[model samples]
Target: MNLPNILTLSRIVAIPVIIFLFLTGNPVAQWFAFALYVIAAITDFFDGALARRMNAVSPLGRMLDPIADKLLVGALLIAFAFAGSFTTGLTWAAIAIMMREIAVSGLREHLGSEGVTVHVTAIAKYKTMTQLIALGAMLVVPLVPGLELAAHGLVWLAAVLTVYTGVEYFMKAWPHLSGAKV
Candidate 1:
């Protein structure tokens, strides 16, 4: 009910609209989607900050924030893959990122159920930023013809970070998974 939670919810709401915009294959609609995405991403950052500042953090916010993030990123990645927006040979990068997301989410849930807490590492935060930047760059590729190389580069870079953080998270949970003492 607070502003922070509202912001988190807004991102989930924006996903379908954004995807529909991309599907239209209209430059203007895509640009609108890009704009909406930028706004949604900004809300991602602010929701947590505002929650802390206002002393209004709630379990609902906690549960929804990460879900919102995964949905937004996952949906955009899938949209780009299906739209063939990624450069040939670069679609694997998108697959890698999506795989990492799913793997890590499953890991977290498993650990949580086992009374183990796995925190978000600093590097993972950077991975998220890189992913958002790469996705944003990809959104502009059609409208900005010369951006293909840069967009593809960003996607590759994001994929590397995604895999790295994913491994780091997995290693952190290795002991628990192996039933060894933590």
Candidate 2:
């Protein structure tokens, strides 16, 4: 119920509206979707900082923040995957990214059940940032010619990082998973 938690919830709420805008296929609607996405991404930063600064942190805020981020990126990635401006290569890259996200989420949940914690690495944070940028630029490709190619490059970069981070997380959980070192 605090401001920090509310901002985190707002990010999730924005996803369906972004989907609606993208589905419209109008140039203005796509652009508005990109704007809304940027706003949502910016709120990720503010919400965390505000929670610390205002001492408004709560269990709900911590739990919802990452979920909001994942949902936003996942939704935008899927939209770009099926959208006309996306390339065949971008679709494959999107598929890889989504797979990695899902695998890591499941792995984390299993580890959490075992009382094992996995921390987000610096590269993973960069991957998230690159993903957000790639999706945002891809959204604008319909309005700006030749931008789809750039977005494709960004997607590939994110894909590489995504795979790397997923592998790193897997390694972290390996011993616990096998019960050899726990």
Q: Report per-prediction Cα RMSD to one decimal.
A: 1.0, 1.4
Q: What is the C-alpha lDDT of each candidate?
A: 0.91, 0.84
In model 2, the runs with Cα more than 4 Å from the true position are none
lDDT of 2 by residue, 1-182 (tens): 98888888999999999989988999898889889989988898899899999998887897788788889888887776666555677777778888889899899888888887778788888888887787777777788887867877887998898889988889878898887967
Worst 10 residues of 1 by lDDT: 84-93
Q: After superposition, how far is residue 168 of candidate 1 from its true place, in Å?
A: 0.1
Can you give the lDDT of residue 14 in candidate 1?
Answer: 97
Cα TM-score of candidate 1: 0.97
Whole-model lDDT for model 2 versus the true structure?
0.84
lDDT of 1 by residue, 57-161 (tens): 998999899889899989998898889887656788888888999999999989989888889899998898898899899988889979999989998999999
Each model's backbone clash number: 0, 0
